[model samples]
Target: MSTIFLAVGLVLVVEGLAYALAPSFIRRMAEELPKLADEYLRIFGVAALAVGVGLVYLAQHL
Candidate 1:
């Protein structure tokens, strides 16, 4: 569906911008990611997922 494509495109744009604008910061995060505790990463990922779902819900309703 068009909505799915739009979501993917928007994600790519945002991700690309981050890499383009701050390649060093991105690399640093990637390098440190493996050193982070698994539980901490899992919690952060779930929180991000919740925020993403909230944004999608708002976009649809508002």
Candidate 2:
């Protein structure tokens, strides 16, 4: 339980830093997302989904 909480807390801290310090970068990325080719976009989406799933699995295991 403590491990899970630590994992979630770490994720939140990193995300919060991004939100606080790189809002423009995030916005730019979002704006540019649609300009990516369909295949590349699909690949990026899949990779992100996989990473997210892996993180959740690790958190659970921890």
| C-alpha local distance difference test of each model | 0.99, 0.90
lDDT of 2 by residue, 1-62 (tens): 98679878988999999989999999999999888899998998899989988978986799
Error of 2 at 21 (Å): 1.2
lDDT of 1 by residue, 36-60 (tens): 9999999999999999999999999
Top candidate when judged by TM-score against the true structure: 1
Each candidate: RMSD to true structure? 0.4, 3.8
Among all windows of 10 consecutive residues in model 1, the one with the lowest summed lDDT is 27-36
Candidate 2 regions off by >4 Å?
1-16
Per-prediction TM-score to the true structure, in the order listed: 0.97, 0.60
Q: Which residue pairs come into collision in candidate 2?
A: none
Backbone clashes (count) for model 1: 0
